[model samples]
Target chain A: MALTDRCDIFGSVHEKGINRIVRHLMRQRPSLFNYGTAFFLRNPNLLCERIQAAPEVLQAHDPLLSVQDPVPILGAAIPLGLNWCLQFTDLQIDFHPGNVFHLPNELGNLPAQRLALRMRGCFGLDCPSEEFIREILPQVEAEEVAQRGKEVFGTKERQPAAPEREPIVLPTRKLQCLCVELFAVLHFEWGTIPGNPQQWLKLRLDGLEIVDLGPAPLEEMAECYIRAVLKLGILPRLSVPIEAMVLNITELMRKQGLAIGETITLQPTPVPAGVPNNPAVEDDRLKAFINLVVEV
Target chain B: MAHFTLAVSEGTFRRSFDLLKRNLRFSKSDQASFGIFVAGYDVRAHLEGGTLDLRADNTISVRELDIRWDRLRFTLGINIPEICVGGGCINMPWPIPDICLPRVCVFSGNPDISISPDLAAFVAQEVSFTGRVVARYFDASVPPPLPDLCAPIRIEPLPDHNQWHIHIDPQTIDVDLFDFPDIVGNLIENTLSNAVRAIIPGGFVRDIILAIIGGIADFIRFLLDIPDEIDEWLSDLFNVSFGLLDFIGTLVLDFFSTCNPIYRIDDPFELLPASNGLIPVRIPLRNLSVRVNDAEMVAEVDIGG
Candidate 1:
């Protein structure tokens, strides 16, 4: 389908659409102090096809919130997994990055809101208990995330003697389908050159490089333009012209006895070659950042 | 005395083998401290399109391995615009070989693995690994698969069974200068004179061919043996090591330690009294063996008291 056709379908979700969903959610839940219209719509391109309810929508709507407020609130709802994209977008939220907002009545009341709150916490929250969190987030664990983060992004100074949280014990079968996605945006900087300088852009997964796009002229240095679609599944496919490298990782996962819900942190970096491996030099020549997104 | 034995079926073995074959991919690298260039070149080889079999005779073999590299090559520093398309280093005159490899096949005897006292940990059996080099040249005019290059090179695995270690002894590896087809040899001799091949005494093209073939074999050995290294490390770390004097002292100490046991359990021949007001028991270990079959590995222990 054409791009506009897809947008229109989502655009026609309602006369008010996502905006209305967000305002209604705000009026219903007072704990959800902040949210946006786009928050509920992931793959804005697929806007109408898959409309997700926001976390606040899943929370208990305090009728008091609507009555206590002087101004009328709008409506919107985002699905649980939608929180993953928040780190990449300009949309703002009051909560800290990677923190899951849960219902205060999560454990006490055990209502339908508990399931919604649990699902949200499963994907994004670093909640305290595993038994409660595992109900919705079957594939990933917060402790594992923290441990993996320390191992991948840790420095000697940053390394801790022990983990601050308890490690989640995982069964063998679920560990077999471990998958992780790494998203990186590399900014290129040329020294005094006006036009796009030629350089190789390399993306290495787990220290092994799967693709290198370069020797081609770069368009601009002002923005981070390079993005990678990491394909980690039973049958691994690295799309082309990069398709020359056809790798199937399912066997390796089995050999390592990886569980289905296990997380594999892919620490990949993209850089212009031949540059000195100095911090000062690299800071000037290029800057790279990464986000690790995982699923069961 | 007590003894036990276990058996495995061919079906289980095949299932395990298929699972292993499916998982043989180089998804990511364990070495990251290395630079991007090094890491990028560390490509993985998989039997993407191939057939394998495991026999009931306790043997596993791969009939074919259609290897394709996991990464595409693009010029890093070169600025020639003619070769640049969509910013990829293509259409270039220079041979920018894929760091890992291109498409190829392994046509050889069925390779097998066996566990025996006479062999080092693991070694390739009955298989003479031979590769068909398939390098894609951008220009159609360039005739592919030079005549002399058609010969399949030999890949040998020399095992150090006595030392309990195996090494890819490519030190004696050689390439026959006359083996190259005359046309192929002449082109390579002249073309490589100006490049990195210029440093080698013989034909540079010939050396590169040897290197590629040897490198592939070496990589296979690495893939097979890397897991063993972890076990070896663990065993070395835990297995006690002692100097000559320490060993003798320990032996004497153990002898003394065993003599003062409080009680004893004897065979029909004799009965001993408790010395330290506690009964001592002696259990005889008659035998221990690890037997591996097509489906399972059984560890049997025979004990007698």
Candidate 2:
């Protein structure tokens, strides 16, 4: 109906991300009507969490079984941010905390694939006792709901905490366990691509310029960092109402030829070990790099 | 004018390219390949010089030049249309190197004016290509090198909603990871080095370290942290330690690419993201995307009298 435009709403139903909230308000009479007008006024943060968790509440359709979730909102937020990047001619965002992740209120970058997102530990603001979790939990689908929450959050808890990242020799805290001297770390560069049937994963932890909290399993320690970075952090997603033009620094590096072909990539020599045999990459020729760099 | 003719498809850009790809040794900077043919010329005369030209200029322009004595020659080139001033075949290696080269000169008028005393040379060139190049002559004349029929860059492209995911082969990974000793050594060395010397001032380090160690034990992680290359750093610091040259030389043939696979992407506009999780997408560029940078190459030889 409108003239040709540079922007388009993805669909009518998902209007700039407010439809879901509108539906939530319709169900529970405005806190002004039921809980008391003053109740909604008491806690602004609580009110926001409720509004954000509306879609989760409406879809599950079980009020007595109420729970607060921040995952999908985080996921949705990612696409929205990425869309913002798309609208710009040059979008440059550093791979830093808050800029790229939404961590739990506390704890980050844990090694486990299943994580809890809340101010307190495992459960959200109001968690059932361990006893209740044990009794009513196994009987129902809370685990399933919990998992859905995890994917939305785009990260998991750090199980097994401090991962002995390397066969390190201890400097201070010595673990008699055969864990060599090392630091615990988790690489956030993990991603799943669509249409890849084989579903193979190439693990890389190099080039992060990672911080060392000292000798532990890097996988576990990395979680702490991820959590730190992702805490209430912005999740990377693809959304519209804006644009989805995420300027991946890595891809840019690849474009600038900073992403050199791995020696194995070229030779495909097939290291019996499987890691691409990366011959030392000559740093980008200063001349070539300078010529193409308008602004990085 | 001496002329040679080579047949190509009606619009045979790909075929002509395939022929070049199959026939030469690669050069890095200019992305060209060089191959040679003596051409029924009498090399028996050593008193005069000769010129190298693509008699078939309308059809083929020289991309690489190979000039050598009895038998020491190096050449690899390509014919990128942007740089081809097709009619400049006045002399072999003309307007180039500005030296007495072993090549025959072609004068739109008379051919003998340009002269050199000790020269015997050959001419070779290539052309631009499209589609799947079906190589007709990649012979043993070139040294054995790695092959990549499928391009690897542009493996991960994020188009609107859909993304290009370059998948790695797990089997290939497992075999490659466990088999290479240097890689394993690198891992073990880094791990071992990292395992030691961590100071936990108070419970912070101890607790965090223990927790991190637990996570690593639980998560099954792989991290390769090679210390920053200090050779250049050290060299820079010392200045005399080869850093002064700051020279990074690559082989005549180099593979400056990675393992990520390349494919096209479709904009999976999110409005109707798969409720069932199956989304439809189209590969934008059905054909592969490859980048080869071979511009101009220079060889240096100084004779001081």
Candidate 3:
């Protein structure tokens, strides 16, 4: 989710609150939520069942959501898993897990209005009793967390020492699967990219990426290109051609609206080798795809 | 000099073997069973997949068998799986730690429990072994003149078992109704002929001569326990000299005028009655396939390569 939405939904926890949480989690988990991670399994407030119901929720005439509305309530269901199913309340949940994030392409419209089909290992949720976590939390609880906070500051052994284990600070995440906070807004509109004149363009912001479906109207006789994303419950074992994924993203954007006048300069990420550049090489092998985006 | 009569067709021959295999149970009364294992008195697990080294002072009979042929598929895609025949002698030597150590000290005579031994004389017989060959027709393209289930030839145990021999009796076949002896004889002859041709082509030109030469090669190779590497090497040179003899034999079979002015060389039955004049090549020719009538053993046999 976008930082603002993440902050609001996480109870007005602004960038400062997030920084504090991250620092605390890092102190607890170490390096994981810090720079060591290439991916982050966010468990932020969502349920597996609700994620499954999201497609129907949107098709039922989506309600216009304000910038502050919780993402799952705004006709867009942010995918989450059951394991690491943390909850401030029954409604507020977190699916983030040990140090990992998905690739932007793998996000598969989880931030879009559709079913949250997973393309990775199922964050299998056994839902350990809250009583269990609470019981384990107090066992051998220590005082004073020897961390940078104490060493950097002059406050020596004062009052009740912070638990020996630092108040958890998530490890530094060097990279992310999706644009975690790259975008500014969370609304969508159909527009036109001048280059692709005949196709209607779709531009959406989940406060992370400015997702654009290319300007395309199949033919004068065809219906609007209907696209949906689904998540599988397991980590997908797929060998994908990055080139195909890139082409797919570009094509989707072109159809939505080649209407954006400004050039969208995208960075070139390295594509793994042996994945055939030709999509047709594996056109029918959808099972091999760990995650997928279907556009009808 | 001797003719033997034994009647068992290929189908009956195979069925008998199968029934015997299924019925034969390992006998506990067999002394070779528990002799050597008790002697080990200090091995954990026992009786696993390994060789049994049978050694004696005067002589050592060792079989470093690395395999059981149950999984080995034959060229004909037939498999007569390996079944434990029986060959272990377990003997425990007494005296050891009275407790756990001694119990473990005794060789694990169980098949599931593995036992390791450096040198065991009366090595506990775990499982016995038997050799088998999956018999399949060489060629199926040609329609069988008679029902294949009733193979004219039956398994006849040879009187002189040490030399290792099998009798191919085709007399039981219907000479008129089916005319299968001709085909059976041809299969045997052609198989021999091919073996000769493979050994030294142009050496055995005529079928009869080829059969004679092939038989000699078989006796020298298999019956006498000669290595094929040496047999093959000798055959190349041996065939040249034998080739001259083969040519002369063919001439005799064709001209000797003992049975008739001329006899058809098409079927083996044709050569049967003419055994009277086979005085010269008789001993050798019959080695490939022979018919001898003596008071004790009246038989027609082939010493297989």
lDDT against the true structure, each candidate: 0.27, 0.25, 0.26
Q: Model 3: what TM-score?
A: 0.16
Provide the lowest-lDDT 10-residue window in model 1 chain A. A6-15
Q: What is the TM-score of chain B alone in each candidate?
A: 0.26, 0.14, 0.16
Per-residue lDDT of model 3, residues A1-296, tens digit only? 22111111001111222232332332223212222111122422232211221232234422211111111211111221212221111111111221122324524333322111112211212333456546544432322233335656855656475444322222221212221111122222223445644323233323222223223332211112212110121112132223333334334445765322222222112212312111111111110111122222
Residue B101, candidate 3: C-alpha displacement in angstroms: 51
Candidate 1 Cα errors over 4 Å, as ranges: A1-296, B28-44, B49-62, B65-67, B72-286, B290-299
- State the weakest 10-residue window (summed lDDT) of model 2 chain A: A284-293
Q: What tens digits encode model 1's per-residue C-alpha lDDT throughout A184-227?
A: 21221223222634332322221111122232343121112321
Preferred candidate (TM-score higher): 1 or 3: 1
Model 2 TM-score relative to the real fold: 0.18
Model 3: per-residue Cα lDDT over B1-305, one tens digit each: 11111211222223323332332322211112243222122222222222222111111111211111112111111222234433544455575433322222232223323334332221222221211111112122455445543243322311221221221211100001121322233345557777766766574256667767556654543433333224323433333212343335434432322212111111111211222222111111122222221111112332111
Interface RMSD for each of the candidates: 31.8, 28.4, 49.1
Which ten residues in a row are the worst by lDDT in model 3 chain A? A280-289
List the candidates' TM-scores in order.
0.18, 0.18, 0.16
Off by over 4 Å in 3: A1-162, A165-283, A286-296, B1-305
RMSD of 1: 35.1
